[model samples]
Target: MGQSAIGTKMITQIGILVHDIEAVSEAYANFFGVDKPAWNWTDTPDKAQTEFLGEPSQARAKLAFIDMDSLQLELIEPDFHPSTWRNYLEEHGEGPHHIAFVIEGMKEKIAIMESKGMKLQQKGEYTGGRYAYFDSIPQLKVLVELLENDK
Candidate 1:
C-alpha cells in the first residue's frame, strides 16, 4: 500500500456511532468489566467552530470514551443537527463510524488526503485541539479522522 497521507500508521481511536449513548455505554462497561464513563455533550458550534460540507453547522453529540489497552474507543450519539456523525447514523444505522489518528500539520495532512480523493466531511475544534474527518470509505472501507492535539 502507498504511504499514509497523514504521515503515521498508528491508530489512536475507533469511533462508533450509536442511537442511545447511555444504554450502549452501560452495555460496553458490563462486557468490558470497566466503569461506565460519563457521556458529555460536545462543544457548541460557537465554541467548536464546526463546519460540515464546507458550511457552518450546529452539530453536536453525546460522547463517551473507553480506554482500551491500545486505542481509545469512542461512542458518539449525534444530535439532529447536520454533521458527519449524524449523516452516517441516519443513513447506515449504528456501527463503526471512523478510525482516527493523532497527527501534526493538520492543513498539510488534509491536503494530501484530498489529493488522494478523500474529501473532507467535517471539521471542528475541541478543548485543546482540532479534528477533521475525511470521506475515505472508498479506499479504507471507513472514514478517517485526523486529530491534532496541542503539544
Candidate 2:
C-alpha cells in the first residue's frame, strides 16, 4: 500500500460533552490515572449574540481542562441554555463530542472542507486560538474540528 499525502498533525485536545460533570470527570481521571482537571465556568456574552446559531441567550458551560502529556482533555457540561453540546447529549447521551486537531492553514482547510460538501457548524476565536466546527460523519454521529493557535 502506498503512503497517503495527508500527513498526521498533532491532536491538541478531545472534548466530551456530558450530562453529569462530576461523574464523567471522575471516570476520566481514574482511567487515565492523572490528576483531576481544574474547573472553570464560561458564559457566552450578550454582546456576542451574533455567534449563537439558535437563540439570543447567554449559555453557561463548565469546563474541566485535564493535562495528559502534551494534549489536553476537556470535559464540558452545558449548564445554562441548550447548546450544540447539550443537543448532542440529548440525542446521543454522554460521550465524546469532538476531536480537535491543531494545524496550520486553517482557512485553506476550511475552504477545502466546504468545497467537499461538508457543512460548517461554527467558527470563532477563543483565548488566542481559532476553531472551526464541521458536520459529523453522517451515520457515525461525530464532529470534527480544526483548531489553530495564534500563540
Candidate 3:
C-alpha cells in the first residue's frame, strides 16, 4: 500500500501525560465543553510483568479515554511515583505527551524507523496491543509512538 494509504488507515490517538489528573482532565473537558470520560485502568499483573515495565514500579497513573468522531483522546495522569509522563513533565511541564499512529505492519514500520536512527525508548504489549516508544524527538520536543492493535 502507499504511504498515504497506510497512514490514512492508521488509528490516530492523541495522548496527554500530566501530573494532575483532575486538573488536566477538567481542562480538557471544559475546553471541549464535554464531561471528562471515565478512567480505564488495566490491571493485568501477569501481563504487565511479562509485557510492561515490570512490577508497576510505584508509578500509578489514571487514563481517561475520550472518543471523538474520528480520533480518541487519551489523558494520562501520573500519580504516586515517577513515570514517563512525570519525566516529561519534569523536563517540559504540561503539554502533548505522544501522538500515536496505529498501523497493521508495526514491526516493519518500527524496523524502518529504527534504521533511520530513531532509537527505541520502550516496547511492550498492553490490552492486546503492541506499543513502542521511540526517542527521536529533538530536545524539548514531544515524543512519538507506534501502536499496533493486535486485537
Candidate 4:
C-alpha cells in the first residue's frame, strides 16, 4: 500500500478549544449562526475508551456542536482531565484544536501515517465512534483528527 492508499476525505468537522463554553458558544452562534439547544453538550462519556502517550488514560471535555450544512463546527472546553484539548490550550493558548477527517479502515490509516513518521498523540471515543489525534503539526502545522464512526 502506497501513501495514497489511505483514501483520506474532506474534513467533516473543525474542533476548537475555548476557555469558556457559554461565552464561546454564544459568540459562535451569533457570528456563525450556531443554532439553539446547542447545549446538547456532555461530559466525557463513561463508556468511551481513551489513551494518551501509549498508556490507558481518561480524558474529559465539554462538547457542543454547530451544524453548517456539510461541515460541522465543534466547540470543546477541556474538563479537568488528561486531554489534547487541555494540552493544546496550555501549549498553544486556545484556538482551532484539530481538523477531523472521517475515515474508513481507520486502523490501517493510522498505521500508515505512523509509518510515515507521524505520531499518535491521543485517542478518544464518543457515542458511536473512536478518534485519534495525529501529531502532524511539524509538517501540516496543525493536528489532524481521524474519526471512525458508526454514522
Highest-scoring model, lDDT: 1
Q: Encode model 3's per-residue lDDT on 12-125: one tens digit a residue.
A: 788887767777778878888899777855434456432223224344467888778788888887564545666676778777888777777877777776776766565556
lDDT of 1 by residue, 15-41 (tens): 999999999999999999999999999
**On residues 1-151, what C-alpha lDDT tens digit does candidate 2 reach at each position?**
6531113456778888877778878888899897666677763454224134434445557889888888888898976564566667788887888877776777887777677566666565555566676775673366877877786
Models 1 onward score TM values of: 0.97, 0.76, 0.76, 0.88
Q: What is the lDDT of residue 138 in candidate 1?
A: 95
Instruction: Report the error of model 1 at residue 86, Å.
Output: 0.7
Model 4 CA lDDT for position 150: 80
Report, for every candidate in turn, its global Cα lDDT versus the true structure: 0.96, 0.69, 0.67, 0.79
Q: Give the TM-score of candidate 4.
A: 0.88
Flag regions of model 3 displaced more than 4 Å. Answer: 1-11, 42-45, 49-60, 79-83, 139-141
| Residue range 41-120, candidate 4, lDDT tens digits | 44345666677777766677778888898988888887666767788899888789888888877789889879867899
Evaluated at residue 62, the lDDT of candidate 2 is 85
What shift in Å separates residue 94 of candidate 3 from its native position after superposition? 1.3
Full candidate order by TM-score, most accurate first: 1, 4, 2, 3
Question: Top TM-score: which candidate number?
Answer: 1
Each candidate's clash count: 0, 0, 0, 0
Clashes of 1: 0
